[model samples]
Target: MRESAAAWGLQLARALGALWTSPNTLVGLLAGVAGMAAGARPHWNRRDCALVFHRWPWGPGGAITLGMVILHTGDTLDVSCTTYEHRAGRCEHPRVRLGDHERAHVFQYMVLGPLFLPVYLLCGGVSVRNPFERAADRYAMHGRGWWPGRS
Candidate 1:
């Protein structure tokens, strides 16, 4: 009973977070829909709790996360990307650790909601000088906490 109650509380918190972040998520949905219409195949990454759109058109290459959506330039971005099904799609990401970095951004969107993009831009967008990106990189590289702070 205690476990169930805790689970319920967690679910409630997650729902609230989703609501808070819905605006950003809606923007992602629009972009994802555009990408889908441009030939990208959409796949659900349950582990990452995101809508992963593979083969997104435009932009050099690499993945970008908007709220709960991930627009990637390659094929699969799942942890199970080694499976035959994913390999058949030609997973071309130079970095296999991308999901964690992007997932960190997703979490940031949950916390910051509408302010995430502004903060990210102010922090230098996608550069190494960005604390958010640093934190996300740490999480991806060392599997540590992704919250922005020292180390």
Candidate 2:
């Protein structure tokens, strides 16, 4: 019982740390709640990252709506049909995939907080020239071995 209590305490601490360090988690949770209200369900990846999968009401041609949350949150990725059916599972390489790309964006959120979106937009968003995208791409290519600051 004592060990269980200690474990629970540790888990609570980690959750608090994630919440404190990453403000995006709050936004993600809010979005996840919205998704839940719309009949979407949350899925957890191997990294324990949480994402919500929903059929977009806006139709097939709608913009990608996933991953709007800031960073360090449980519900980091928001998946629409496009992200779910097309991007993530199609990769032949285990490490390189859309999830990794999105996770990299999560890391960017961790560092940038609320400014990530604005800076990402100014840097061309997901374009090839965007540093954030490039960093994410590199992370997808190299797993945790890659990060933004390294050459």
Candidate 3:
């Protein structure tokens, strides 16, 4: 019985994956864009994307979003390890120490509390931009290439 249940679950997951990747999904993509903007998580830069999806030692509120799951690559393993949670709903540069509590305060205000909450909520369900894609888009015209076979 358990084996059958697991197999059925896997099939359902596969179907969902296919649906998510289908071009037709774009028909309703505006909702997603609006939600992202609402969360106040406008894509800042490559690093911003990284902080959103990889930063760890997370405070309290954070969760894995579809974007992060899809964008992750093997090279980001180190950054991923360093970040405690990777889903704080707001983006900030992660640091090892609190820096006399000054930076910690900033994170608390700018990211954790009121300032960032509305935006995070607006993004709908804690989704973040995909860092790999953001980086590729930013450096697309660099000619040679930042990394081989990256595109």
Per-model C-alpha lDDT, please?
0.76, 0.51, 0.30
lDDT of 2 by residue, 1-151 (tens): 9999999987786555455435566666576566566654556554524343433223333223233332222223333122221244543433345556676665566556666667778988655566676666667667753345563
Q: Give the alpha carbon lDDT tens digit for every residue of 87-145 in model 3.
A: 34354434322111112222222222333334435534222353322222223323222
Worst 10 residues of 3 by lDDT: 97-106
Full candidate order by lDDT, most accurate first: 1, 2, 3
Instruction: Name the regions of candidate 2 deviating beyond 4 angstroms.
Output: 1-17, 46-95, 144-146, 149-151
Candidate number achieving the greatest lDDT relative to the actual structure: 1
- Winner on lDDT between 2 and 3 is 2
Model 3 segments more than 4 A misplaced:
21-69, 72-80, 84-151
Query: What is the descending TM-score order?
Result: 1, 2, 3
Query: Compared to the true structure, candidate 1 yields what TM-score?
Result: 0.81
Q: All candidates' TM-scores?
A: 0.81, 0.55, 0.23
